[model samples]
Target: MSTALNWLSALDHPEFLADRVSAALRQWPDGDAEAVQVAEIDPAIADTSALVAATDITLESSANCLVVRARRSGTETLAAVLVLATTKADINTAIRKTLGARKCSFMSMDAAVEATGMEYGGITPIGLPQDWPLLIDERVVAQDQIVIGSGVRRSKVRMPGPLAQQLPGAQVITDLAVPIA
Candidate 1:
């Protein structure tokens, strides 16, 4: 069990996790899933700011997984961007260039939900579509533990930050985001 998540309980209710997220955790090669903990919460507090205020998790230890669209030559692709709660992904510059797209921007809630089969505000990198690139900021990977979406707004997942790199298609990129002042 992760010592950092003393504030959270073990997986009390498996139903709290999204289907894909549960599967992903169970597939962890090192049994790292055993170290993960989850907590059920009101959907209203599932968003980052409210989650921080409603629980012991701090902003620094929380990560936000966003869905962004990359478009080039009329072709559109979707990718997941994971950044620390205190930073915003540099979508227009860094991401667009990295994705080799003429345009890159956050995807609409409806599109993201339909594409990922995860509720908005709870789309985690753990269960993203394999074809969809999952970009993780260096800062987020540096955290000891991170609280992120559980694929459902009713709960959240907390795991060692580095575990994010282990996701099937995750790519650790430097300067993926800029600190929010």
Candidate 2:
């Protein structure tokens, strides 16, 4: 395990990563070098504030992944967006337009978990449905390293920030999130 993976106690094999994330990593440029470091965590502390308080990791080093849904002409579209914890995704204006939908909102928790095969509060940008867009906020990729979910509340994945840009269907967008007041 890499030093970045040392914070959390349990390290899962690459095979344990979300299916899509594992496959993407295998095909990524310099795959081994871009490999993500994962560690198990208490599901109770999986949320940002709790994770930071329990693990001593700073809030700025953590990122949040959200599932957004949009509907237009009775058709539904979904997307996964990654943003730093300090900011919120500009879903109404930026994301709705980007998705080309007249109406957009966060996906219902039930729908998200069922569709992604991942637990609530643990959904990640990795392993999302291939047809769905994966949006990476510019600010998130600007960091040197970031802690993100591992598709299960029991674990987290840490990797170089820019590595997210290499995932299948990823699109780095500027101003994807608005800084919290």
Alpha-carbon lDDT, every model: 0.86, 0.80
- Measured with C-alpha atoms, the lDDT of residue 110 in candidate 2 is 100
Q: Which tens-of-lDDT digit does each residue in 42-118 have in candidate 1?
A: 89988998878767789999999999999999999889999999998999998888899998889899999998899
lDDT of 2 at 41: 75
- The alpha-carbon deviation from the true structure for residue 126 of candidate 1, after best TM-score superposition, in angstroms, is 1.0
Cα lDDT, model 1, residue 26: 69
The alpha-carbon deviation from the true structure for residue 18 of candidate 1, after best TM-score superposition, in angstroms, is 0.7
lDDT per residue as tens, model 2, 1-181 = 1123354321236634666566655565565434577777778988988888788567898999999889999999988999999999999988888889999999899999988888888888877888889888999889898888888887788887888887768999999899999
Candidate 2: how large is its RMSD? 3.6
Q: How far is 51's C-alpha from truth in model 2 (Å)?
A: 0.3
